[model samples]
Target: MIELKSPGEIERMAVTGQFVGGLLGELSGVAAVGVNLMDLEHHARRRIKERGAESCYWDYAPSFGNGPFRHVLCLSVNDAVLHGLPHDYVLRDGDLLSIDMAVGIDGWVADSAVSVVVGTADPADLKLIEATEVALEAGIEAGRPGNRLGDISAAIGAVARRYGYKVNGEFGGHGLGRTMHEAPHIYNDGRPGRGMKLEPGLTIAIEPWFCATTDKIKFDNDGWTIRSADGSRTAHSEHTIAITETGPRVLTRRPEPGEGAASQIKQAAANS
Candidate 1:
């Protein structure tokens, strides 16, 4: 069943989303050449401890994933696209990295992800990352009330095709709330004016992930990570949003570039 969040519940989710946004911002800034992926995991753990939040992925056991993902971070580097487990590998210049995170605050959950290139970035890598970001924005823009879920999916697909990328239909966005993943499976491509009707008080995560080559993917030996089938680089972008009577409200917005999501999470931490 599709669950609609109450006004107060949505507000609680905003706080959770804000914290996640800030966490991703901080990680992106520190991710650079010579930095070990384990270091990023430690940093995320520290922040979660300080804010008194719980990691949704740490103990998450999905059929597709290895039992109980024990890491606080998903560090997908280069060809590795989604659910990249943090190992002992150190980043190198021109390497592309995608970080996906989810945390629970006051029993509400928010999930988001971003892709970045360390040090000197390759032009192709930069373009791929930019495409995912813009596609995410387009999906969010179509998330207003009265629109169908297909509108958001079609909007994302249009952006991907314009950039000459293929969408992986296997994994995309989904409804998020008290749990990390929920009902109303969101695909990256669909026909507009179809699917479920968008209504006020619905909150969903919109993610756009694409590859430069084929839409197929292969699993890593780790049983947790997934990558492009042709070994081509991929990028992913995501955000948690709320559908309102007015419009789609972005709950995970960062206050400024590289500032992290400091506006509400910091204030909430101080109050707590």
Candidate 2:
């Protein structure tokens, strides 16, 4: 069921969100070429532990999972999309990596994702990352008090289409709260002002992920990691947001307080 949060609940969520947002920034500080994905996972776990927050991804098993996920982070590198399991893989120069994390603080869950190019990146690799960021921003802009869920989807889809990237069919954003995944799936494509309305105290995850080529995907043998069907590279960006009386509040926002639309747009242009 879709349940709304009370004012006190919203305040608690914001607190969890601040920690989650700060964690993403901290991870980015250590994210670079030559860093092992496992090492990054350890860093995240250490930070979350220090804050007395729990890593929700660890030991998490849903209906499709063959077993409990034994890791603390979702490390999707290059062609990998969502649910990328972190192993012993070491990031290299020009590699585009997406790090997704969620934490339960005081029984509230906040999730966020970011796509960063490790080192000196080639032109095409840079373009892919830029497109994902642009698309994510468009989606975020569409999220407001009067807009419908479809408006957000259409905005995100338009950005992806502008760059010739195709949206993967299976995975999209979802509602988030005490549990990781909730109701009302947010698609990458939909009609504006249709479906659900943006209401106060309703938290949702806005994620925009696209493959460089085809829309199809295949799951890794590990039954967790998802990659492009044609082996093409991918990029993903997401933020947990709550609908409010004023506008949408980003829970898992970027670290730098100045990292808003203006700064992000400039970064996207420079990368482009």
Runs with alpha carbons beyond 4 Å of true place in candidate 2: 257-272
Per lDDT, the best of the predicted structures is 1
Candidate 2: lDDT over CA atoms? 0.82
Candidate 1 residue-wise lDDT, 179-251, digit = tens: 8888899999999999999999899999899988979999987789999999999899999999998999988
Highest-scoring model, TM-score: 1
* Model 2 residue 204 distance off true place after TM-score fit, in angstroms: 0.5
Residue 94 lDDT (model 2): 81
Candidate 2 structure quality by residue, lDDT tens digits, 176-216: 88888898799987777788887887888888998888899
Error of 2 at 221 (Å): 0.3
Each model's lDDT? 0.89, 0.82
Candidate 1 — worst ten consecutive residues by lDDT sum?
261-270
**How high a TM-score does candidate 2 get?**
0.91
